[model samples]
Target chain A: MTTAAITVEGLRKRYGDVQAVDGVSLTVERGEFYGILGPNGAGKTTTLEITEGLRRPDEGTVRLLGESPFPRNPELLRRMGVQLQASAFFERLTAREQIRTFASLYGVPAERADAMLETVGLTEKAGTRENKLSGGQAQRLSIACALVHDPELVFLDEPTTGLDPQARRNLWDLLRAINDEGRTVVLTTHYMDEAETLCDRVAVMDHGRVLRVGAPSELVGELGAASLEDVFLQLTGREYRQ
Target chain B: MSAEAFTSLSKAMALGLLRDRTAAFFMLVFPLMFLVLFGALFKNDATARAEIVQVGRVEVFDSLPRDAREGLEEVLEIRRSDDRDEALEEVRAGDVDAVVWQEGDEVRLRYSAADRVRAGNARALVDSVVQQANIAATGQPPAYGLTTRQVEDESLKAIQFLTPGLLGWAVAMGAVFGSAFTLVNWRKKRILRRLWLAPVSAGTVIAARVGVSVALALVQTAVFLGVASVPYYGLELSGDWWLAVPLVVCGTLAFMSIGLVVGAWAKTEEAANGAAQVVILPMAFLSGAFFPLDMAPAWIQTVSGVFPLTYLNEAMQDVLSRGQSWGAALPVMGGLLLFAAVLTAVAARLFRWDDA
Candidate 1:
């Protein structure tokens, strides 16, 4: 049997007095578009960071493609793509140069890097420095950089948090196309509509723990709720903030 | 993969630094400005001649032998002033450095103390001439003659020493500020976390930064030496000057490690900048990068010994000015290597991929 693309069990992480990710557990099947839906300060970013191997868990086990990620397994890293909440690029580097540098890190060819830029619809802005790009353009460039190596699994942490509605829809279409390429995609976002529209399944999270995990419509129907927002309100007995 | 990452990262970092106009100004132009300013100020190689007014037909001047009189004339521009009161007025008015007259067997010299160095020089020269005349009158050869020779090449001027000191300051500022600012900014922007997520090793990332800093340091050294070597500055390069290459590398590593520590410890760009300044400014002064430490108090000189920049400046000056051999710089390089190692370990211990 093929293993799950990612399996995280009993994940616990604490920062100072705060339990950022307390006893979280989840799994994503290969080629599935998954989302961790939460509000700000709800531990989505921390969980994503731990899962991406950018942070170590306090106590847990995480397996990506049947291999542990921490202690930095390069083989696993080569297979995974992670775009953090804040997009970062080399100082003063143009869009093409930024993606090319990332590609070079993974030994990917420059042609592929340029092609990835085109894939993000940034071909005309290839010569534009990263700082000069608009919010939407920057986010797309960041996503392109993350996917330049064509990893088997991708993680995006709040990719559309500050984008306008139109840019958000554009990014959603791009994310859907990425998932359509048979790559498993894990995303964290606060927008209920975003999860309902893009996720095959989403894990509803709050206060550092997963409340429930199911298909967005199934969760709505299971609780006899009008939407994922109502499902969150029903599950937590509180109004959804975002 | 690491090799490729290193190359790409180094290239990116180099380009970033070159493109940053502010950083380029600080790293390259600022210190070179100090070099040129100080070079121009100290460019005069000739010893200054003191202007003296002979208050009368001074008997001592006429009694001096012909060759002795000519030699004194070269050091002292003597003008005859028959009016004693006029000569004294000229000395007080700063028109002349001193006024000399013979009163009986005693030669009285009157000079204004406002220009102490010139007054002191004139006093010493006049005293020596009088002593020589006294000895000649007794018809006795001088008991002991003193000869002086400079340890360094006679052509070496103040600029020769100033060049290396300023060069050391320039290199230190470049490496330290470059690394500290880069690290802090990258961490704040989450680039460190991004790079960590990639397959590249941390060593590759740090090595790339070090490689870029060292390369820039070499370029700074070349520019400093090239500019100082011009005829206007008259900085003479001599004996194992090439040894400064290794010294520059070691010094850059040491300073960049300090920057790494600052970067790792600071959570904000402002904090990092403040911390870097706190480390660099005092080091530049105390390390004798701006002036000679020997002229400082004994305790200050002792305090300067603890700084890695002090040794860097000293060794660079030795190779560049005193024409010292490799033996002179080897121990200093070893010290710098130790500093680099220890500070690097501290930086690693303090390093965090993200501010969180």
Candidate 2:
């Protein structure tokens, strides 16, 4: 079997006057926890969406699990999972109903949906409507839904952007455990500590282009910085939150 | 996979609509309220009585035979007046429908032509009364007396026409408002965006929504027909009542396609609401739902002919009031089907999952 989870070459996208994803290229290996770190408007989410087959690239090639992501190939989409930024669910549906509905869409057994909710620590609140879920709980529901079908590759875009510290840490642990089970995980965020603590490899991006890519410790060591935050600032010459 | 997706989505949408209080009211309660309110407001006006002033020769008016006076009384309410000019003033001021006077051997009528429909009814009644008197004067068997009877299957009341028109209005409202608002709200909430990421195709999503819309349309039709046919309204229906099933389906589908077009064009729920009003308001007025087409101007009737609701109302009236067969309503049904197909194609062309 092929070991690479995703591959991209010269991927490009434009929105009128703005070149949102300009010639972006990267590769993610199977079982690798990859993080794309960037500031706001760095096109991190755009790049991830294109690679996940949620969007079409204006130019260049993207392959997910050795198959092209263009033209919305159903076989490719069926084997991949995506968690979007600020994901929403049906307002009046209970969490279990929402999850089971999506599971059936993927032809997964109903029992799998319950197990997935348990894995996401939402078993106790399975009957809560989506509109009633707290911000953190909603994010966890999104994670549970993404992992319900147990695909080979997963993409999460800014999964912890609005989460509290404890909730963020809990999610980091869940993602780490999933990665240890040998499924490829790719996520995008702006948090330096998140990338350092959870990612096996990191790519620092700005202005629609990737500036650097390596193991977090190795990048810090090469730059002679005290931490990945210092290394990121040194490389981009801007604060991590900018 | 498409079938499963379609079924799941349809179930979810129907459940969601039921849970939504605002949507439930708009879909279920509002249409019936309109039916009862408007039906009650205009029910008695169908056979409007004409008011007449007998200005001169009260003895001449009183001299008419009792049967002739009774026949004219059905159409006219006569008020006596000794002064001729005062009765004419009443007619001019629109206080009375018309004024009648007897001068020697001839009787004359002075009426305000502005109220032409009522004035015409008064004139016909007065003419009949004169003919009756002439027949009595001859004192022989009449040569040409007309005979009339009610057709068992046909309904001639204005409410008969209004019921079908109201039912058409309800179906149109359900289809257009339901589809437009739901699509825009879901798109704004990123539901469509999320669904696009799933293995389900766009065509499945659309099919699911259209299916839900059609279901809602049918339910609205059934509820309205059932309520209107009760003892209160006594909807005069005949022929194959089942023909209403296909009529509602086609008519509601066409309006739903219009809603889809609005959904594709509107970027926000508020915009969708505005667009729906713009489309539905004119259609409701022009479809002859509020009044008969014969009562409206020629240009308005011609313009209303282009609206699908017009055909729907026509088909409904044909099936319910005229007791016509399904084959008789083919032209209107064809128009609805063609409208639905064409608009659905346009909506598909215009539809987008994301802002980009």
Candidate 3:
């Protein structure tokens, strides 16, 4: 099969005199863990939103499995899962009940919800209200809801922002497993260590434009740098904290 | 996909409603609030006695040889006063409900005619006593006849005149305030954004909200209507349960449109609550919530007429209390349609899918 799962050509976006995505273009190989690294407000979320069909670009063409990503085709939405940053649920609903509700939204079978709860390691705490869960548990529940339909492509925006080290490591393992299952995972994160470890390919973005793109080793080696953080700092004209 | 999809939407909305405890409380309170309110209206304050005063010596004053003094004392304290002006001033000041004055052959009753009914009752009691004493002593009927009258030109109460307004007030609140804040809460919680990303349409969202609100408004109407029909309010419900349908629908559309406008406009729960109340209280009070608008200022009436609740009250009164048919509420129907249309447009224009 042809390798690329998503193809973007000459993507551009502007917000009231500020260009958020400037002639950005890229391609993601099928079953690859594609990580986009950027600073805060570097238009990472904007680009992801456009790709997810939440926003339309001023100019460009996007092909997701060879179809437009939006008027938000139902067939396509069913195949792609999204995890928005700082997302939440009603406090009164249990984790199991919420997952079931989201499953219903996709017209999926009830057993799928149970399987997702099991997959996310929340089967024991499934009966607990989402608000009562620890941060890690809630994040796991969010992931469960997003993946209940077994989507092939996942968009995770800062999947580990509020996560502790243990939770983040748990999530990284989950992502690795998902990638191993021949799924395409597109994610954005500011954590350099996360980018170096989890990503199969990296796109270093600054000021809403990708300044560089390569394998982790290629990006690091091009700068004659010891770490991905130095390569990011050298290329983006900014420093990475820690 | 359509049938199964509809069921999924229905289930989601039901779950959403159940998830919000405050929404549940407001939903329940809409009906019960008016129940107690209308119950209090029909409650009898008549058990309390009214105060009045009797005065003057009558035409039979001379004939009551033995018992006239006692007869006068029994009707009132019978304070002896020479000044008619002073006694009339006290009556006008509302020191007592009414007063009486006696001339040589005719007895004159003096009190503010606005409260002339109390004056008439006091006059009757005094006349009967004086006439009994006359028959006992002179064995003759008094020459001047007794008459009864009232002090105030108007008599209004909470039940009959106000229940109609209360019914409208409750329905209006259910529609506008309920609708707006529900949307605001959904948006605030990012539920709308989540919903937008789903397969649901904007039209479906609006329709679902309408369905939920109409169901809520129905419960409120039933409770309020049942309480209002109790004998205390003198609600004379007739043979036409079918007649209320149009009013309920109109009220649902009118208020919910106001709500949609509010929900579309407000960014936060607090802003929505405040905006809804600002519209609600004036519509409740100024649109004859507690009393009739007939005696209120002409300008006030004219201004109140511009509110949808005013038309709602008039329509419901025509149907539930007065037993008029749906055809009779054409004025309300026309006004509500206009109000609903404009408010809906404004709200739709202002509706923001994002937090910004």
Measured against the native two-chain assembly using Cα atoms, what DockQ does each of the candidate structures obtain, in the order listed? 0.81, 0.61, 0.40
RMSD of 1: 2.5
Q: How many residue pairs clash in each candidate?
A: 0, 0, 13
Where does model 1 exceed 4 Å of error? A237-242, B54-74, B79-90, B93-95, B101-108, B130-144
Ranking by lDDT: 1, 2, 3
Report candidate 2's interface RMSD in Å.
Answer: 1.3
In the predicted model 2, the residue pairs found to clash are none
Per-residue lDDT for A1-242 in model 2, tens only?
Answer: 77488899999999899999999999999999999987788889889888877788999899888899778788887888888786658768889988988887788877999999999999999989899888889999998888898988888888887889999999999999888888899988778999999999999988899999999999998889999999878777754544
lDDT (0-100) at residue A25 of candidate 3?
A: 87
lDDT of 3 by residue, A1-242 (tens): 66477888888999998898998788998888999987776778888878888888999988887789767787787788877776656446788877877777678777889999999899999889867899888878887777887888888888888889999999999888888998899989989899899999989887878889998889888889999988877877665532
Query: Which of the numbered candidates is closest to the native, going by highest TM-score?
Result: 1
Q: Of the candidates shown, which would achieve the greatest DockQ relative to the real structure?
A: 1
lDDT of 1 by residue, B1-356 (tens): 37888999999999999999988999999999999999998777455789998876667788777888898888888888789998899889998999999888889999999899999999999998888788888998999998999876899788988999999999999999999999999999889988888888888988899999999999999999999999888788887999999999999999999999999999998999899999999899999998887779899988888889999999999998887978889999999999999999999999888876
Q: Kindly list the per-residue Cα lDDT of model 3 for residues B12-39, writing each as its tens digit.
A: 5566666677776665665467657655
How accurate locally is residue B268 in candidate 2, as Cα lDDT from 0 to 100? 87
TM-score for chain B of all predictions: 0.90, 0.82, 0.70
Cα lDDT tens digits for candidate 1, A58-166: 9999999999997889889999998878898988999999999999999999999999999889999999999999999999999999999999999998899889999
For candidate 3 chain B, the 10 contiguous residues with the lowest summed lDDT are B150-159
RMSD of 2: 3.7
